[model samples]
Target chain A: MEGEEQRDGSRGGEAVNGSDSPASLDGIEAILNYEFRDKRLLEEAFTDASYSPENCSSFERLEYVGDSVLNFLITREQYFSNPNLSPGSLTRLRAANVDTEKLARVAITHGFHRYLRHNKADLHQKIEEFGRSIEEYPLHSNGMIKAPKVLADIVESTIGAVFADSNSIDIVWKIFKELMEPLITLKTMKKHPMTELTEMCQKRNLKLEFRDRWQETKEIEVLIEKQLVGKGSYRKKLIAQNRAAKNALDNLDAFFPQFNQPCQPM
Target chain B: MEGEEQRDGSRGGEAVNGSDSPASLDGIEAILNYEFRDKRLLEEAFTDASYSPENCSSFERLEYVGDSVLNFLITREQYFSNPNLSPGSLTRLRAANVDTEKLARVAITHGFHRYLRHNKADLHQKIEEFGRSIEEYPLHSNGMIKAPKVLADIVESTIGAVFADSNSIDIVWKIFKELMEPLITLKTMKKHPMTELTEMCQKRNLKLEFRDRWQETKEIEVLIEKQLVGKGSYRKKLIAQNRAAKNALDNLDAFFPQFNQPCQPM
Candidate 1:
């Protein structure tokens, strides 16, 4: 065990000690299960422009490259496996897997945020709120929760770093195949609450209207046939509207037991 | 030359002859310069769902995969080649290279559409119109001309078939590198006239409005402060609007010499 620890320590150096290293990229290699050939790429991946204004070169480029790599990798996998899947379905499946919420979840699950070098003031609070919000859905809140874009960016940048270091897509895939765990399969994927609610209402010929009180009250209410079915409030009007739609979906059964009954189109 | 033809002929068999063959996939291999190991994939790539209603399979799947492959290939190339290029510029460059019009031009240049098996009416007329329209703007017309989607689909499907056949991205790149010539680079890329018009108008504090006369006369007129500056008509309303914008841009200097002069904000 001592020999193993020494071998690992020798590879990671300052990362193993859990101390403030010169590079400040401690424990990242262990989390990724892959070490970088050029440690600077790793450092760059974690560094945000806000943290070091003097060094304007941030992870945007890496994030961009990583975004393409992730998209291609996911597309290749899903294209071959789902032989009968339509292009539309494939697109949705790919989006669900690599979207901001999904990538943010990946970052949090691996504790990637602990290593991110950013000076954004409200990021921590937003992340905390996201953490709490995700607990309700456990898989994906679709559009109900707001995910910090930086978390997703870091995850992409890390993938970009690995690709740039190795210059081999196969190697990147091998490393990330396991890292992106519990891959959102077609069977496990869920429709956005807004879409679900709209479809349900359309099928039943029920009148659906979103009353916007966002400017005055920062709240959105979903009304069906002049009766308030659900209400949700958020700082962002779009989020509030999505949440209201979700709330309406959740309470549909109790609010209207005859929701399934066909009615005259309004 | 006859011996070489015989050798090539043996490989492609029915695909080589100009006559009706078992697969009806003739002359495609010669055009592409890369023969497929699975001839059925070639046939499938060329086959439209309308051509074989019984099979109910089309080039859509292959086109989807090819679209992904082409996007990734362009991204990888541009990312490495233009180290100083920002993500926004990179995106625009990639889009200029892979958009429907550009790909359709590729199809026409290589005669890839000759082997396509589709039963759509008016396709020939559309292709001919596209051919004539492209003559005016040797490169891209930005948004002035409409491209037949089937032409682009075949190019993507062929690329997808080649990738699937070899299961090697490098091979696909190698085969397509020369085939996809005159790639739109930063130097060659031109902004859409609509975008240019909007920018020019905004800079000059000019109020530009598009009046839709499509329902009455299949025309879209561009008005600057209620004065008619340009008029354009097309079967498609969107195209008509774009052409009106382009016309407005062309006549901007003559119509409003005071455009460069700073004006009071509306």
Candidate 2:
């Protein structure tokens, strides 16, 4: 589906027409001033497939690498960020953070949309304006569908660029954390296993216990109300134990919804 | 590690101080060329840590990524190069080809010894001959010991450089194949399981039969000397008894050392 004109000119600009645009991307850069170190990568990150070949190389390939890098970085960050979070919870959180829509939102918040160069032929190019366009173009058949993929691609490519430019993991984390600030709220961080289990136990007026004991082999065990619920050997480590406890807690609803309910003198 | 001496000047030309005979790196470029598509990467390959940061960056990191990329590219190439090869065999071949010492030897054959540069304080710097210089310096060390970890790291970096620069799987394989040419002889290729299995069956005058027959579902089974060895089924296809024998014949292990011996009724 092709159209002659759009209400907004998000894609078309002097830049697309091979003319210099007076609007410098300096403002966004200042806010995200981590210094990507690799200028080539930064340019590539903003580059869209719609741009002519001579203008720039698309961020598609960088995005591919970036997507994996982000998964790895975020997974690692989440694991170490809150030691109390369980593996399953971390996994779910990771999924939520890395899902396309979430990342697209992050990209948007970081002023990613302003830097994009869109197509003049299409009427509905801006991602935010998606009401009548959805009805008119029907994403599956719409030419604009490629835009999201490209935008997401740019997001990942920027990450790859950041990683390449700087060897420091801390610096990279700072950039990611800043971009994902809106999503990674204190509420999200506090909703770990410890909090979840505590809340669940409180709601039912059930007594909860977490006994941490170390064995001769330096193994850590987390017992709940005299039950041998979770154990972590030296090799398995604390992370494993935390994850086990979280998993065990998640299943409490189906198995033991009423913790205070007295058993019939069995 | 720093010492200086002045030499006598001749009538026409004379050696001055700091003129350490102008390193006779005659054929070093050729060796680097074999592994890298661009001569720049080759230059980087031979660039030891000795050069000041102003001169050039060492090949240490490139070599790290190169080694992994080389393995990945070669493993993929070998998989497709010989479609009949099993995963295990391909893995062994990959391992053998990518060993550090073996790659060092490849560097030697390619005349990499002539061009090696290292910091004077580096343990490898105390050398008299080019070949000995290579052994003493172990450029792959990245200013560390020639231990397993360092060696593995260097090998990977080199592979990564080639993969990134050349971006051609075929060229990468060619470099890898050349490096492994001495170790992987035509004779050795014949000893590969698939090849040996085929030959052994032929020598014993045994016919490999793969019977694909099943009442409930279509199945394909490999038989050496009419003895079933391995089985595969396409029950979902629901096209059983449809040339199961022919499919089995193509997948026969040509290099299997003990084909159908278990099935023979002693």
Candidate 3:
């Protein structure tokens, strides 16, 4: 047993004593046994950037690969899930989902944070400088940060590890799905101002313009072909424009549709 | 030889003629033998996205793994080379070096393009739609539009494959270094506008504002601050705003340090 411990410890640099290692690879082990299929991949997956280059492969590299895999998977899944959404809508959805906060959250939920080994002091100092809690740090906290370059590598490394251990997509997806379920709430996905505005404008064939009438209080004026519809100050112009556009769209949908078509046009 | 050909054809799910089989294996084997220590990784590296769900293993998944590895290699190489650059500058440098155009160029130079296999129709359709030429497309172009994605995947897969075949980073780096050498060109990496503007503004301690002013004529007046930057008429305010901002930023570098520095009193 001691010899076995020594081999596993040295196999990938840095073996955790009893307290640090998870008791049941129940969550991670299933992935190892079924998904990774290759032990090298499993070793790579659990690897954090802390490992010395001479002793072990760092998860940093795997995290990079996992990021794209996650992106492609999410894009494919979302596209299929929401067939009616335009490309722009899908893009926003992806941005919201794949951004650091969400990805870290997903990573954490999967017990991924436990496996990660990075510079703790650096992460803590960064959070302090940002006036955020240490818990909010993506590396330490909810794993939500805009660091695609860093976080993606960690994520990919995990995937690589999972594959190494178990070597099956089905097992990997089981863990991935659990982690992602909360973020993929139907209610959260529905509220996108840009998507709503674009859909409205596209249907009506009316150009939405938030014209800036600089003379009047540095306010933004909304004009639909020389006729003023609504106006607001500069700060609120984006919202106002969207509102004005939305209102105009709503009016068009209600009024114009009555005259043009007997039933609601597809 | 015939038996070997049959096994290769069955494993790869490709129709193979006995005569053509040896020639095919020669190149694949040469790359595989030299590059990877694990043959499974080599097989997975060559596996295309087209075969993903239909087969238990797809190159798409491996591509996912490979992309991160390539990114890490490139990023690490660049960061180590230029220690003085800020994170933002490093990011831009990385982007400039890793974009599809650059990756495709690197991929071709390394002869990695020759090992790729894809459906011709899908490849042609993507090229036409995106206006990418064959020369512009990286390997696995049929699956992903971005060249870096394909390039990163191929690079990673090749590494994985080589590791599978030979388990040697020395062998992999041999090919990787050759491909990455051209991307290290400092001349190709231009400073991003935002970075320059931020740096210029910081030196001057000047707050930048984007304002839209009106002219007496039919065209709208656009200004960075008070100066008349552009006259009436272009629909895209974004273009005009950026140009005005650029002009303001250009004149700033010379005068900016004088106002903010401790050497000169405020």
Error of 2 at B228 (Å): 18
lDDT of 3 by residue, B1-266 (tens): 23465334323232212221113323555433352335566555655565444453445544433444455455556545764454456566666665665555454444443455443335423323333344443332221233334544555566555533543335655766655665544555544344555565555555654455424323443333354433323334443444445555555435443533453334
- Alpha carbon lDDT of residue A60, candidate 3? 49
Q: Which stretches of candidate 1 lie over 4 Å from their true place?
A: A1-23, A53-56, A213-218, A225-227, A255-266, B1-23, B211-217, B222-230, B252-266
Clashes of each: 0, 31, 49
Candidate 3's displacement at residue A148, Å, is 20
lDDT of 2 by residue, A67-139 (tens): 6557656655554465456445666667656766456555544545556554434422445442222344321
Predicted complex 3: DockQ: 0.05
lDDT string for model 2 (B1-266, tens) is 01112101211122111233323332332333453346666556556666656667666646644644565455444544664454456666655566654565454444333345555553233222223434553222221122223334334445555655765445666765655456542235323233444465667767765454565445656577666655545433222222233334345555344554554543
Off by over 4 Å in 2: A1-28, A118-126, A130-149, A185-266, B1-218, B221-266
lDDT values, one for every candidate: 0.81, 0.49, 0.47
The Cα error of candidate 3 at residue B52, in Å, is 15
TM accuracy, model 2 = 0.35
Q: Could you arrange the candidates by DockQ from highest to lowest? A: 1, 3, 2
Off by over 4 Å in 3: A1-91, A98-187, A190-195, A217-240, A246-254, A257-266, B1-73, B76-84, B115-266
| TM-score leaderboard ranking | 1, 3, 2
